[model samples]
Target chain A: MDFQTILILAQDAITNSAIYALLALALILVFGVTRVIFVAQGEFVSYGALTLASLQTGVMPGTVWLLLILAFIAACMETARLLVSGARHKLPGALATILAPPLAIAALVKICTPLHLHLGWQLILTMLIVIPLGPLIYRVAFRPLADATVLVLLIAAVAVHFVLVGLGLLFFGAEGVRTPPFSDAQFTFANLNVSGQSLCVYATTIVFVAIMAWFFNKTLYGKALRAVAFNRNGARLVGITPHLAGTFSFALASAIGCLSGLLIGPITTLYYDSGFLIGLKGFVGAIVGGMASYPIAAAGALMVGFSESFSSFWLSGYKDVVVFTMIIPVLLWRSLTTAHYEEEE
Target chain B: MKQFLASISMLAVLAAGTAAQADITIGVNLSSTGPAASLGIAEKNAISFGPSVIAGQKVHYVIYDDATDTTTAVQNVKRLVSENKVDVLIGPTTSPTSAAVIEAVAASKTPMIQLSPGPATISATDEKRKWIFSAPANTTIYGTAMINHMVKKGVKTVSVIAVDDAYGEVSTAAYKTLSEPKGIKTLTIEKYKRTDTSATAQVLHAMQGNPDAIFIASSGTPAALPHVALIERGYKGKIYQSGGAANAEFLRVGGKALEGSFMLAPPVVVGEQLPDGYPTKAEALKFIKAYEAKFGPRSMFASLAWDALKIVEAAVPKALKKGKPGSEKFRVALRDAIEGTKGLKGAGSVFSMSATDHSGVNQLGMSLMKVENGKWKLEDHAEFK
Candidate 1:
């Protein structure tokens, strides 16, 4: 009720919204281009947070091993495909593609983690280790079933989520881990003080959003992605590779998820399973946006964050109910207003 | 030749029966790999230190992982009773799982020692709790210790925020029962689910009451959310946490935000820091040393398990005088012997059980601890006034 209290609540809402916005953006991007719900989007978040935590302790994270394994598997699949197609010359290139990045990343991690490198480099290393897992997952799980029904792809995504969660537990253990804040400074504005971490969240979110917007509107690759999202068959007819678009979308989404995890890690202790609930919140945001418009999805995510913050004040026990219930009216309105169309077989 | 073969078979049967009677089986069902795995793993480690022989009888342990699910715990208790035919049952770590196994233990009339820090509601009265006993101090002791500290500090009003689970509900109820009679007004009470990421709304609502203190009744890493939010909102009042949050993981996750927060924990948490004359200090230190030597650090749940085993060790000799180790009569004798425990100091607390009270430890065994510089420090005295 007081001015200061309201300001504090607003700050909390903004910090939470910033993270949710990134998740929503990632979800929408992957779903748009790939037509997959990407339920395992949150696993990348956990991976990112835990990877940083491991690096902070001056130990090489098991994530590097996971990356190597996934990359090797993806490479084998590609090699097998080339061999089956009788493309003998491309087999060596395929092998190189599968083997090089993971090995280089593993070597870099091995050298830097023991040195107790600065937090900035550790964060970058964490991101580098986690981001490629996205495309590798897509290649191994989703791409093979690309011609399958959307329902089948969604089930596969759920399966991936379970596998990643199990793997997360094996790597991180049952205990939750928290990292030190990026900046320990506090800024005072008369009656209010804001942590530097909150500022970082806001700044990073804004920058990433702007970068994504520019990329989607201006770049050739981005335009091609938009084309595939618009109509996959039509984009293929125009010589744009659908597979390339899917891989790019998945990679970008994974990066967004990792960044969100890094930003939120200092604020809360993260376990292997923490990402699913957080990602589900973003899914709620995506639904409010009708799963199509990026700006609207971001706005919806902020709404969710604010509603959760304020509702926890008004009805602490039912805040989750309140936040999740917001979707009901949106769903009802969309059902009544939007046209229903069935996809062609 | 046929008569000789029959005699040999009869001898084999008698020998097997004698071996089973001489070996006393203690079944341990714990949450070793689930949401409560951290606590369960600690309990498992402590129970490992139990004696291999008790009262001149071989003690054999049969351990099962319940994964913190109530259904699994119940199933494990059935298997331990019907299949293993164990003479005693040790655990199922968290309060809910412990509560779930009560019926199974009671049905089999098996003596069970639970290691959860909650009220022994599985059997409320002396007659009903004949087969059940708990190791940790009751939830009411935590409430009394906290409220006594509050009243000493001249705190007249407080607000409550707890997780909406069995542990949270019991602790909050106990706090309410103890605080209100002492003229401490509870301005508001709020609840959140266990896995919630933020408690901003709860903190804000609690702040509106403008109480002198705030008691958060959640446990583990999630317990840090409200404290972090409270500090961020600049609400500087006394913050109290329940015993469930008395683990090192809470501090590691909470960081500087939890500094100066008060909690009522068993003495084992601050064993090295306890006064020399403290009754539980020597025993607590011994267990801590042995545990840390093996597991890197001693946890509250581990201490509770160690204490439970101590109670068993103390009761076994008394029970043995009444009947043989494997008989139904021996199980009854063990239950009676445990109930008769008085002033027996163990790792976490001193036990003094009676027929009416299955949870024998009280506020005397609990110490007031405050988080200082991200570590628990024992307050020399509870008299803040």
Candidate 2:
């Protein structure tokens, strides 16, 4: 309970929360524009984690930065391909594009094991394929279903969750893959000692928040995106393709998910189940953040993270109780407030 | 055509009765896939191996996948009992699922060999429950063994990191009670989610307390490498783990870190080199060679399953003396035969059983092994209390 211990633990919590925030924001972005939810976002996160894990294990000889750069480039190319292919048609184009990454990741995993690549590198390669592939999925899967009922779209989202979950188990197996330990750099101010890893994760999340805020505010595309969110028909009448904006939102969300995967990857050692747990927490954060408010969502994620850490300090045996208890009240309050807003509007 | 059809119906009825008489049905109600597939596979293989080892009886197994869930276990057990009319039930691996099936199996008056660990609520205690017999070695044995060792070693303080489940909780509590009287103080005990693997922070916190050792009670592969991780951070102290880490997978996962580290195992099941001309050792060696040839390489989990099945094989002759194999009388007879066995030789070692002693095997037969080149080699053997 000394200050140094407190600081280090707090730093770890913040870093974790920041990563959760990035993921929640990405999820929010998809929901905001597409009026759809994708549960398979965790697969993309796993991809990033596995990528790093694969690289570190000497399975891949590439440097960390090189791996990151190559992955991003590959992602960009895949996104472009998805956008162009799904541009004109609706049925087959969308289906093909949406299903490609998962299929590719599965193939890569089967090959990588015999190749003697590090588990970390294999994970990274998978991430590289998955996160970039998310945008294409939105372009293909969400756009065609745009005119469908919310219930149908929700069902599709649930389907996506199952598909990803099934694929994850099929490829990765059910066990949690062990991650090799890495060194942590320390940052201290009097009684606080924050590890370098936590700091990096937090900083990355903040950077994404600022960049995304700028994207939505300063750019012409951002304005159009906002207009689509505000009123799709009005935006369409004004010559903006609301559907295209929806695709862009998904792409942005996918990239953020990649970052989230990398940051939180070490905390749980990359596993298929990480998606469901992290996704649930991210959704909780989104709800607390007003569902539509990016800043509020970020704040809510951080709050949840802090409460989880703080409660662990006191309620050692029932830390989970502390976390969910706090979330329930906040969620209830948010729901009541949102109801009032709807009535007022 | 009508006369021919009547003749065929009479022939089919006679064939069905003869077929029923020819085979003794054994139902396997364990998971075949999912998270606990390894354990399920072990249980299934063991049960299958039992029939092969049996001298003269033709045992047909009806396998059902429990999917590692309690509700599924109940449904499968009922199906096996009512529909298949299996003579005896062998499994429902892991604690929770086995507990769920206990009520059904006991109510039906069906004899069962509960092949699971403890902390799962048994529908009835030892006195009340006579029909159901656990092959034994519950959490109490593991906890008591570790506590006894720690006390003898003059260990004064420790920290525990256990999986947040009934098995882990029971062992942790038992350890705490045993540790206190011996003046072994616990610094900070942490419970981790079964799926969680990140223990560095927990380890660091435990280290901060500067306790004498750290007791890891997780059954996951993630917990296996903590010895290496702890060593990496420059902490030099004794490390004690639950029976979960006694398997070969831990050695493989931890590699050099596991060398010189101690594990509590259930006797030396597999031979320590080739033993001198004993038929049991020879048969075990043959099994090892055949298994290696077929499966490439298997962990200790596979070996344990192999031995468990051998026990079943030894009991079949006396149990099946009755004319009808599926009769309740046959099952009870089988259970009694299994309990009465003593100094039974197998691949693992000599194991004995009695009605009161269910685990049939305990740690006294347990020899301490160390990881050498990622393979476990015997280091020390001690008698049990």
Stretches > 4 Å off in candidate 1: B1-20, B124-129, B193-195, B380-385
Give the C-alpha miss distance for residue A330 in model 1, angstroms. Answer: 1.5
Q: What is the C-alpha lDDT of each candidate?
A: 0.86, 0.65
* DockQ of candidate 2 (2 decimals): 0.28
Residues B41-136 of candidate 2: C-alpha lDDT, one tens digit per residue: 765654544553245557788889998888889999999989998877777777778778877887666666666656343323364355565554
> Which candidate's lDDT is highest?
1
- Model 2 docking grade: acceptable
lDDT for residue A238 in candidate 2, whole number 0-100: 97
> What is the lDDT, from 0 to 100, of the residue B251 in candidate 2?
59
Residue-wise lDDT of candidate 2 within A153-216, one digit each (tens)? 7788888678666756655555554444333576667756555656667678878889889989
